[model samples]
Target chain A: MKHAAPTRTLLALYTAMVAFVLIAPTVVVIPLSFTDKASLTFPPSGWSTRWYENFFNDPAWTAAFGNSLTVALIVTVVATAAGTAAAVGVSKWSRKRMAKAAQMFLLAPIVVPSIILAIGVYAIFLRLQLLGTLPGFVLAHSVLAVPFVLVSVSAALAGFDDRLTTAAASLGADRWTTFRRVMLPLILPGVVSGALFAFVTSFDEVVLSIFIKSPYLETLPVKMYASVTRDTDPTIAAAATMIMLLTTVIIAVGLLSMRRKKIA
Target chain B: MPDKTPGAGTRIDVKNVTKRYAKSTAVDDVSLSIEPGEFITLLGPSGSGKTTTLNLIAGFTELTHGSIEIDGQRVDHVPAHKRGLGVVFQHYALFPHMTVAENIAFPLQQRKTPKAAQAALVASVLQTVGLAGYQDRFPKELSGGQQQRVAFARAMVFNPRALLMDEPLGALDKNLREKLQLEIKRIHQDVGRTFVFVTHDQEEALILSDRIAIFNNGRIEQVGTSADLYERPASLFVARFMGESTVFKAQVSSNGSDWHMDFHGSTLHGPVTSTVPGKGALVLRPEQLRVAESRADAPAGSAAVPVQVIQNIYLGSGHKYELRLPDGSTGIVRTPLTERTSLRPGDSAYVHWPAHQGVLLEDNDLVSTT
Candidate 1:
């Protein structure tokens, strides 16, 4: 292909740079997850599933994974419900200035620095006697997930016709019935995507969980982090590989579901 | 018919209602009383407050200044769902989740009606809206026109005390709009329910309204029948708004109990008015002007305006003549297609009106610039 000088140079430079930056680390790590040796050294002298077996076989690793799953699920449920409800309330009051303020408040979880939220959550959880408890972590994560839910559901609610509720009200239906029968179904796809985001956020979170939870109630990220800090091993690499796999699947599913809704 | 029996008339009485939103007055001091079985259309341009009037009657907005009485009982504080007034919006606004049957059954369900009776009512209302076989279909599966029928069914299912339509046909294409207009008229006739419709389209208002309330700026400019507004408009706005007309300045003088207007350097005697006698202008509808061969001793058709035909526009039904007089003030003369025997560009002709055809207005021509 004949190429202009700048375009050809940029394309070549971007391709090589992307390959070095993205593929290099991933290529070095995947094989390490299956290393027979205990050390995290690349170009391993042997190959086996010993690290994977150990990660699944050890009660501590499995328990931490289970705890992470539980926290993510609870956060997803609470965030999706509260965030979708907020979306509907704001949609009905869409054109008003107050609705705009409520929307900004909902998205403040994303806009404000995570450190501030972590500090606030830590302080509140301590007073509530919920420090180091699973509920406290889940609630804090759900607050982080709400902005995602609000954004997704708010996008869906943008195209919602306000007159639909008026039409329902003019008929025999009350406000609650109108929301249940009319608004919920239309906004379900966005809510599901938001819920998936909630799941992913809490599942993969490294901060807040690091500060708030105890050593006994360590999430998968905290456990893997603690293991890496104390010593470098192929087991930590194995856990990292699994977490990446789970997150990739969740993100892919959320994107596909949203796309399917749009097409339909 | 309602006037013939006591306690039957005056289905809706709106007494000096007003709605104000910070720094903007949406509806102001509006008052209208709709008789039972009457079709009163509030007609005006956008933001003229007709839609606000309908919303007030439907209990959509809280009235700031006045009370709304339905059947002589105050409904000013009633919530929209409890007002018991059926409403059809501009958009079809069909519930996306529900099937046609479910949407229609909603109102019945809200009232705690029995299940079997609710089904029967939903079926009957669907039939009334001409959606008999589409009961199981969801709103998204139907066309725009079908969705509108479902909206109609949903609105009328509860047998509301009155009906309010806010430009219900505003979204449809022209053919569908005209078709639905007829269907709405038929439904109104069959039900004989008082319908207060709000629309800015004057032709739609004229065709559907028993009497129209023409609104402007936040108040009712005039309220009259279609013929009344077309034939004898009260003000310049009403006269010009109702239909096409060609108006001219005339200096009038009284001659032997007959008022004559001086036009084109000639005296033309026409209808005598009880108002001021000095000077004013005469307004003529384009259709009311005629070309007469004889303008002799008959003082009624005096001062025939000698004009050169500039252009003739052929409307499908008739011919519209763009004629220029000696003065530069432009006006149009409408003639039927069958009578275009000698009329064309650059033809000499005299345009005159019968005495009764002209309506006299004060010669305040400066205020009539638009």
Candidate 2:
């Protein structure tokens, strides 16, 4: 076996160093979250799980956590259904020009600045008198999450062999039966991965949540933001750690399922 | 394996069917009547409308004009799903997620067959396709040939009125394809169903079909039994497509029932009569033409043309001698290895064939690029 050259090794070390610098804040916060001291200090004194207990015992934190989970669940269901349908429709468009245009329009949320999108959504929700409601947050988050689902489902659709549908039709299956038996199973992984992505997008979203949040209806991110600005509480680090852990688990499951599908 | 499903074979009538795209016609004014229990092959090159004609009959594509009838009932307006035609695509199109048993049972399930009946039918189909114990293997787990067998089983399990195959064996290796071709022939014989097969392979068509329809440029040039198309092709295209042959340009003249053609300068008489006087092509199959040492040794009354050999190719069972004709055109002749004649490149010889063996195609040139 041949070892890498010195220059290549240096380049790899540089990339790892850059990655560490980018994620340093999160790494520091995790350990601080376990600190026994009252203030947010890393490697300070002994370690404890007091902040985690604080997160679990407090009613405000628990309410924010519940609110975030509910909104993310709603967004995941709405976005996956609408986005998967849109992907199938877009994949079926005969005219290349129309399909390309529709794809660009559907993916506009990903390219637009988040703050501008938040303000625009806030304005629309206000006019609809849904600003502080659960539906408003769910709808607003779904707007951002839909693009991820659409992209994931579209990628799956790209590799689909349409002749199976024709074969199913010829074999005495109606259109709906063909979709349910053949098309759905083939693209299920894409639909599932897209739904997970939509969930994660809604759960960690803060910019839009900040704009639409009411005092009575705060998501985890909005509450964390308020805690950081109002008080120098270390419990914010615990909240960040929990959100990170949730996203990590979701992503890990998504990757594992995708790998299993590939192997199968 | 017994096929208990009713109505295995159905007569299909395609009356002047035409399918036109915006830019060009895929199938144009084509008509063919396929008998029940007959295996008819649509043979042509890619983009020559053979597959399009199959699709039209299968109701996958709507006809631009004319009608199609299945078992004497018009079905041009029926959708593909309601047509109940068994179609096997070139790529197999097996559902990757389904086990072989489930795939074969799909049509039965759709028609609401009882679970016990579906299981029994799937088992029977698996046995019929020679994959009796592969019930739980998914499509992705099977080899290409096994997948194709599963596809055939799925298409046949439902006992559709007619089976339409579009280049089903095009993807396999040569040995596997030949093996599967024999399997298909056996299955067709056992089932006794009408099969409309499409392929670009002339040899496969000749070997497997009772009748072969040769398509060229969106139209069927000719449709007949393998021997009919091979021996008495109606047009220049059919003669060129069916097999290898050498052509000579000649001028036709007739005396009532007898006909004679004037080659470059030599005159030859044939048993068939020519109704008109004009230039036509004299098609001679390589097997019919023999190489003689001299014009004097050639068969009496046979058309003999002197040529010089360009190359001799050893073909295991025989030898093929490529020659340059008197008119400076190329010709090929296949001779058995047992023949005593010794020929080599640059050797001078006369190629002779009986007058009755040559076919005169009117208004045809000796060569065609299409």
Candidate 3:
């Protein structure tokens, strides 16, 4: 499928344009965070690390950062456990139509508009008197994060042989022992990736968090949204850069570990 | 029975076992008693309930009717893991993530065997399967035959009451399959445990089994030793399934002393071994048939049919001839190299067999829908 010279040139140009468009915003934010200017202006006239200093020193930013990390970590654990169980159960269901319906239900959060879910959660949280609470934010973010876990774990289970479980049982292993000894070690790669996805989903959530956040409990994304409207500073760019770096490192680690497992 | 020696075999009794799905019956009223220390094979084509019967006995499948007993104790309520039977699947379902040593040690660990004893048992069983010093390798690293041997070692390490195998050698090439068949037979002899093997290859079944049970249409058509199945099949389906046969569909008429059948226009006489009336077939094995140059050269008092030699295949120890009978149906005749005849393609000859060598079986080939 080699292309003509002119066609190959055109294809390379198109690919480069798409890549620049996708990466420009993130790339620009990194440089803007190092600017000496107080405002977030691209191609800054001077360079400094004052914004990074402000991002680390400010109590509001620090609290929001800590809150975000805690929620993301907790959501990762909860969502990974629930989603892996759901995936295994759905894979073993003998009634295919019912299994398909259950899968669609688990994935509905990813397909439905975020605003609709935000409004629905806000109304329910208001009635429960949980509008300004940590549990409220954790609950909403977990609802959005679980689908990522489910998809990754289900993909892993798809390649797993169902006969291995039968083989385990014939060798005198009970259901729990078979799962812990045979099934888990095989599907661990999927579970790890799902946990990382869950962490990023909760860490970056804003729309649902905006509906549920309180003055006392604001995640990093919610605080960033408030900052952009109330102030014009390069500190927000520093925060964005940090978030990008954290997720990229997490994803890279996940991919490397999965690749190593495959090689082994 | 409860005090039977460990590592010794246990008798399995399946009484009128039937497994019925919603649409069709997989195993229908199949009853067989397997003796301890006997190697029995469930021989049938695909979907003929041989594997299903093995699964039923393994407790992986539930029997819809009747019961199964191990050592005279009913086990219909037992789970697969609790039944303590070793099972080797066709694909050698070894745990891919585990090393060979760990895979074989899994059953011992499940039984709460001590750590030191588990290692000793795993090593001993691996050596028994002739896979010593290959313990650290993963299943994917081993060849297909090696993986199957590892599977065999894993299934046997726990000293189960009996061993059940479902076409364990089916995934290998013909040469490896034959080689492993001998290894499996030797292992069976060394263990002296009851083995219930399932296979569709009749030659493999005959080579390995102490007794073979022929399954057809979810029923046990016949159960006998290899010689009993090959020489004296109870029905036409058994005769056709066991080996190659030359069949003559005829109307069976019996006198007080002998049985007679009309083949084309000639009358053939056989001993009245069974009172098979009406439609029947005179089935003779290929070796039982010989090709003579003419009717005058056929043996005295032998039933002979005029045929044209279509092709004569030279076997190493004998010659096999493809024959065209008078009714256009093909027949086969095998003669030893010592008795090589002048028969060649396009030559007129008579395919003859001793009257006593022909088995007069009921014409019930249609009994098996598959």
Choose the strongest candidate by DockQ.
3
TM-score per candidate: 0.84, 0.90, 0.94
Model 3, span B230-320: residue lDDT tens: 9999888898899988888778888778888888887788878767768878888998998889889988888888888899999998999
| Candidate 3 lDDT, A83-119, residue by residue in tens | 9999999999989999999999999999999999999
Candidate 3: clashing pairs of residues: none
| Ten residues in sequence with the least summed lDDT for candidate 1 chain B | B1-10
Relative to the true structure, candidate 2 reaches a TM of 0.90
For each candidate, the alpha-carbon lDDT, in order, equals: 0.80, 0.88, 0.91
Candidate 2 local lDDT, A1-264, one digit each (tens): 565799789988999999999999777888988888888876768898999999999999999999999999999999999999999999989898999999999999999999999999899888998887899999999999999999999999888999999999998999889988999889988999999999999999999999999988989999999999998789999999999989999989898988898887
lDDT of 2 by residue, B36-131 (tens): 889999999899999999999988889999999999999999999999889888899999888998899998888888999889989988888889
Local accuracy of candidate 1 as per-residue lDDT tens digits, A1-264 = 899999999999999998899878866777888888889877888899999999999998999999999999999999999999898888778378999998998899888988888888888888897877888888888888999999999988888887777777776567788787777787788888889988998898877788788866889998888899997878988998898888888889878977877786
Q: Can you list the residue pairs that collide in candidate 2?
A: none
lDDT by residue for model 1 over B1-370, one digit each (tens)? 0022322323998898888887878778888878888989999899988898888888777777889999889989877888888898888777777788888887788888799988888888777778898999988899888888888877777777777889988888889889888998988877778888889899999889899998877788778999988877766567777888776666777655677776777555665655744556667788887653334523564447766778778898887887676554656778787766466787766676666567766665465333
Comparing chain B with the reference, what is the TM-score for each candidate? Answer: 0.86, 0.94, 0.95
Model 2 alpha-carbon miss at residue A102, Å = 1.6
Clashing pairs in 1: A172-B107
Q: After aligning candidate 3 to the native by TM-score, how far in Å is the CA of A3 from where it should be?
A: 4.1
